[model samples]
Target: MENQKKVFIIYHSGYGHTKVQAEAVLSGANSVDGVDAELIDAKEAAGNLDRIDQADAIIFGSPTYMGTISAEFKSFMDASSSKWMEQSWKNKIAGGFTNSSSQSGDKTGTLQALSVFAAQHGMIWVGLDLPPGNNSSQGSEENLNRMGASLGAMAQSLADQGPEITPPDADQKTAHYYGARVAQAALRWAA
Candidate 1:
């Protein structure tokens, strides 16, 4: 497994939906034969900086609130200042996913924020590679990337619903695909 790639998923979920999405991403990354993915909640990542520094790729996830990443996620990004200063994460693959209550809930803003944070850390950004799904008459709602996000996975969950009832299967599948894609990219980068 010398060629194996290690990916760390760092995220914060206010109501658990984002955690589910993170799990899907982890599952997808684990599907790759030489990829090992681990989930670290943003709230708890302070103790895991070593893992982050050792990772070949990092995938960030967050719930969109007020048109951007949740406060907890923002805090995590802010705390990475030391890494930024030292360029510890430089050139590592970076990707992200975000969830919101509405289809157009400015999820892009969150994605943009994540991308910018990654860029500032000198990480290479990875975009979702899947074509837009559920965009045509023949497309099914079950299709992946139905939200048409190019930068990362965008997921919609009902405001009143719990994680178990929202972010639908399609969104989770999109996240899974995104994780797999990032891991693959990380593997290639390592090679």
Candidate 2:
């Protein structure tokens, strides 16, 4: 495993829903052979910036709050200014995911912010390759990528529900697929 590629998932979960999505992403990344994946909470990301710098891929996640990423996740982004100045993440593969209480919670805004952040660091942005699911007459809520997000994985949960019951299976699957895609891209990029 000495040559294994590392994938880091950095995220902030407001009500545990985003954390569930992050775990799904981790599971997907780890499913790839020779890939080692880990999750770092945004709250603790500042202390682990060096570890993230060494990763071949980095996936960001957060709960979409007020049409954007949570303030906590934004803080992590701000803390990485030093790395940005050094261009330490240049050429790294990057992806993003977000969750919110509404179906169309402007999750794209959060993903866009993440992609822009990666671009600022000179990292390559890996977007969801899945075609829009649940967009056809035959589509259903069980379809993956139901949110139809191409920028990144998107998940929606009910405000009244907890992470254990919300975000649904399809959204979880979409997050998983996106993670694997990023990991696979990282491997290819490194090669």
Candidate 3:
């Protein structure tokens, strides 16, 4: 695994649902033979630009709150100002994921914010490449990309349900695919 690429999943999960999605992303990244992935909570990631700098790619995840990224994840983004000033993340690969109670839930705003954030750092953004799932009678709940997310993985979780039940298998699979896609992009960038 010499010269192996590292993918960091930096996120903030309020009710543990987003954590489940983060884990899926990690699993997908690790599935790539030489790619290493780790999940780091936003609280723990604060002021930790070194890890971000060293990683080949960084995938951001945050529970959508008020139609945008959660404040906790926003704090992490704010803390990276130094890195921004230094342009340390410039040209690095970046992607994002978000979860909410409703299917739409303004999830696009969160993803858009992530894209802008990545762009501010001069990072190349990677998007989910899958088509919409659960769109027709032929589409199964088990299919991936049910949300038709293109900017990144988007998940819906019932406010009353636990992570075990929501975000469904489909959303998790979408996250998995998104993660693998990012890893592949990182590999290409590294090469």
Cα-based lDDT for every prediction? 0.91, 0.93, 0.92
TM agreement with the true structure for every prediction: 0.96, 0.98, 0.97
Predicted structure 3, TM vs. truth: 0.97
How big is the positional error of residue 175 in model 2, measured in Å on the Cα after superposition? 0.8
Cα lDDT of candidate 2 equals 0.93
Ranking by TM-score: 2, 3, 1
Tens digits of per-residue lDDT for model 3, 13-40: 9989999999999999888878999999
Per-residue CA lDDT of candidate 1, range 121-184, in tens? Answer: 8899999989998899999879899999999988988899999888899999999999999999
Off by over 4 Å in 3: none
